[model samples]
Target chain A: MTARFAVGDRVRVDDRTPPGHIRTPWYIRGKSGVVADMVGAFADPEDSARGGDGLPERPLYRVRFRQTVAWPDYAGDGRDTVDIEIFEHWLEPESG
Target chain B: MSTNVDDHDHDHARTFVPDEEDSLGQYAIVEMAVRELLIEKGVFSADEFRQGLEVFDKAGPHLGARAVARAWTDPAYKESLLSDGSAAVKEFGVDMNLTELYVVENTPRVHNVIVCTLCSCYPKPLLGAPPDWYKSRNYRSRMVREPRAVLAEFGTTLPDGVEVRVHDSTATMRYMVLPMRPEGTADLTREQLEALVNRDAMIGVTVVPAP
Candidate 1:
């Protein structure tokens, strides 16, 4: 599945947690960010491990999250941002 | 290239261990299969794998310490470090040709920490393989969000008035913390100073010169 979010689009990572192995680091799971760039599609290793071969490759997105949103009291320069590369399966569209 | 059939089988048989399917058995199985297949196809000789494993085995904990020591002693280098980290590393005689080296500095106001949210992107050339805890989801998730909290859990508690900055490692890049050296070690030699910078200090969970 191709991720809907693209570079410069404001989005929030869904907070839902699922059982089993995941690649999304726990630190940025529920944090929001703007999509930076899309890494080419690749096999979802987590899904492929679960007998999901023939599974279509999914596009990966590089999401850039502001440091403040990830940390409540982050007292840095306030312009600090971190870019995270997440698989398509890990993200969903943010609702207004 | 000695392509003797008997020698080829002998080399494979020596490296292949039974799959216990427990602990690191899966990794071992995969490693053995890949190595054996590659060797059989002459992608790389058995000697290459042997030499690689030897080099890895020879790696010690002192590599990271040596880098830290050089940074502490050189002021111009430190400035270069703060400006362009990877380039400054070249001044120390450390070759980071294979991987990207990220230098995170620790200041009085803010402490720089590093975590690989995905897998361990360790500076194998300098710091060697990462500790198992580094790959744990618990470390990746809690460290960035609640750095102080996570540090405390790891038996590291900073005093009041210090800020924590966590750098999440993604892609092929690796990170190392340039910790603030403790006082009273001024008279020590470079080797002595190197001993003070621990792996935990580089990880930013603990301060240097563990006293």
Candidate 2:
């Protein structure tokens, strides 16, 4: 399947927690970030976790977030940043 | 019963059992049972399972060290490595298959560190299984929260000017750090350079010290 978001699109991770194994971390959930890179498509790990055939691969993107935004008590300078790989289903385009 | 004191002493000796925790004992029992079931069902033979394990056993950090050393010496190769790590490692006879490898570089301004926040997703083809600490819950949770503190525990103290970029391996992609080549190693041979590259350095816990 083709990727919906490009390298520079702004997106926010969906905050809702699903009942199964998810690749997105809790800290990055509901946080907004810019897409760093497209990591190609692969089997949805959520489905694979349940022993179900992981078909209909989803595009994964490396989302970059400022360290300060991720952690309120972040000790580092503003230059620090974190990159997390999030599946397309977990991300939504940020509204203006 | 008191008539046979010698026989009673031996019986007590037999009854005394040491309380030791064999961490792998339980897993081994389960693994053997599962293997037997699979074999009985004609899934895969024991020989095939052993062969697969042997492949993982043969892989080590040296393979990744070779790739890092090559990148240090060759600029064009470094570019290729930074762009496509899985493809560039093939030059050194390391096959990563379809596993996506993204090589993050550690520069003067940017210091890159990696962690599998969800689970232990590592570049096992090049570096083998992760060290015990890498898979610990402390490292997984703390690394993303306080990378500098974690690095310091590994005896790595970076300058305040550098930006600590932590890459969370949260998806199918696995990451390896292309650590900055230590200064004063210009005269060293390729093999010597490779020797200096350790697993921790690639994981971004510490830098390769100059030898």
Best prediction by lDDT: 2
User: How well does candidate 2 match the true structure, expressed as C-alpha RMSD?
Assistant: 5.8
List ranges where model 1 is wrong by over 4 Å: A1-68, A71-96, B1-27, B83-98
Extract clashing residue pairs from model 1: A27-B141
CAPRI quality band, candidate 2: medium
Evaluate model 2: give its lDDT: 0.89
Off by over 4 Å in 2: B1-24
State candidate 2's DockQ: 0.79
What is the C-alpha lDDT profile of model 2 across A1-96, one tens digit per residue?
A: 788899999998899888998888988999999999998888888998899877789888999998998998898778889999999999899894
User: Residue A6 in model 2: shift from native, Å?
Assistant: 1.6
lDDT of 1 by residue, B87-189 (tens): 7666655566645566768878777778876677777766767788888889866666667667787787766666666666654346788899888988888
Each model's backbone clash number:
1, 0
CA lDDT scores, all candidates in order:
0.72, 0.89
